[model samples]
Target chain A: MGQVLAPGVTAPDFTLHVTPDQTLSLSDLRGRPAILAFYPADWSPVCGDQMAVYNQVLPEFREHDAEVVGISVDSAWCHQAFAETRHLHFPLLADFEPKGAIARQYGAYRDGEGVCERALFVVDRDGIIFWSYRSPIAVNPGADGILDALDRLEKQENSDGRAQSAGNGG
Target chain B: MAELKVPVTAADHARGGANGQVVLVEYGDYECPYCRLAHVQVMQLGRHFGDDLTYVFRHFPLTEIHPFAEPAAEAAEFAGAQGRFWDMHDAIYAHQEQLSLLFLMGAARALGLSERTLEVALEAHTYAPKVAQDFRGGIRSGVNGTPTFFINGHRHDGPFDYQHLADAIQSVRSGL
Candidate 1:
């Protein structure tokens, strides 16, 4: 398993292909909280089940303006097939070419495995990592942890907003 | 293991086997295939452990993917209003392959629930708050997906298949 980042780190930036022709960058998610789901592979049992769970809960995430993106070392073409099979609405970014490059920056790439650890990172609107978790390789770490992080993020923002208003005597 | 944050109360739908030695709480979605399978297994467990088990179900509908789930849950609540909660629940899971508003209405009618009243409740989402409460409780209890189980107020991370669950229930039952 790779390293799991702690909260408050500046989430590393990268652009990865979502489809053969379309790519998404970390900057694309600047205005909203982004959930970076780094998993080992597309079709592996646990990964597939985990992604499907996220697919089912995507709306709940969007209710908080959090966009979920899956990352893996698979090629974009492979991602295309896998996303199709799963009917996933979110984009799965392929950390290809320099395989596991982005995952490595997040300390989520498994050494010599050529795959990602079952890692999760929640990045705030300012690109600061809000929370992260690395789960066991075989277990399908469900969306609960990600959702909890998002909820915490929302709570923090709300309280900060209240504090700012209080400072302004509003 | 995560423990159940909310204890079972009269607000919940519960059924018991003989001695009530174990409590199995399932956070389930009506549209989830795994939950449908677990429904059957839970029923089987009901037969096997008769008086020793008390099974409880709560809604955790993944509405984004399973749009019909929330509506189906509402219908179940509608039936619950008439004291036919378990009947409606079993009916919906029995026809799990065909879950929809129309199917739910049909099931409601078959169970002697007024179709128009069910429609009104569905449109108004009368039970959504209750379902959402169950959902929040599940989230707080570390439920990640449909068919998540809590055995005697503790999270059961192991497989919920018949034998595994039987062993789990047996262990919990024996502990009492």
Candidate 2:
């Protein structure tokens, strides 16, 4: 297992292909919080179900205004087929051309397996990582931690918004 | 690795492993195809372990994907009230392709359990809370999908094939 990027660090930015033609950078979703789900493969038993669970809970993530994006080392074509098979609504970024480069930047790449570790990052509205978790390769680290981290991020945002408003009033 | 947040108790439906040296808990869904395969694997493993392995099954339905899962879990729980949990659990998985509200009702009847009791409970959503509690507990234990296993309290972070699971069990038991 690789040493994962921890909370309080700025999330490393990369623009990966969402499909053959389109690319999405981390900063593209700068203002709203995002849940970066870095998994091992496409259509594998664990990763498929993990992403499906996230797809199922998209509404809950939306309640906190967080966008969920899947990152893996599979090719864009492979991801497209997987997304179609799984009926995935979210974008699956291909860390393919460079082969786990983005995953390596996030410290989620497994040098031994040539795939990303099952990892998660909850980046706050300002692009600072509010929380991060790395699960064992075999376990599907569910959406609970992501939701909890987003909850805390929302509460902090609420309090910070109030403080800013109060300061402006004065 | 995540630990089994809820300890095995009388409330859980356990089989075959009395005074067992190892405890294997599975968070499962009736509608999951993989779980059907896991069901058979567990049976074999139980026979192998006998008194050394106690197998406990918990409900962690992926309700969004498998809409029948929660209700099936509730039916299993209702049957559990009559000491027929394992019966209903097996009957439901016996025909994984035939899972639905209609299938559950028929399975209950085929097993010679009460339809009225199950209907009333399903209507009232009586066992839904218990199912939800199990689901929440699974999330707490880092269970993202069905057929997750915890061997002797620690999550089994390996493939869920028969041989791999058997090896994992052997290793865990020897460590004990």
Best by DockQ: 2
**Candidate 1, residues A1-170: lDDT per residue as tens digits?**
53688898999999999999999999999879999999999887557767877886777899888999999999999999998877899999999979888998999989877789989999998899999988777655777688788888888887667322344222
The lDDT leader among the candidates is: 2
Cα misplacement distance, residue A3 of candidate 2 (Å): 4.6
B62-165: candidate 2 lDDT, tens digit per residue: 76667888899999998888889999999999988988888888988987887887899999999888888887677667677778899988888778889999
Off by over 4 Å in 1: A43-49, A56-65, A78-87, A111-113, A154-170, B1-3, B17-19
Each candidate's interface RMSD (Å, one decimal) is 3.1, 2.3
**Each candidate: what lDDT?**
0.86, 0.87
Give all TM-scores, in the order shown. 0.85, 0.80
Q: Deviation in angstroms for A49 in model 1?
A: 4.4
Clashing pairs in 2: none
What TM-score does candidate 1 get on C-alpha atoms? 0.85
Q: Report DockQ per prediction, comma-separated.
A: 0.32, 0.43
Tell me how candidate 1 scores on lDDT.
0.86
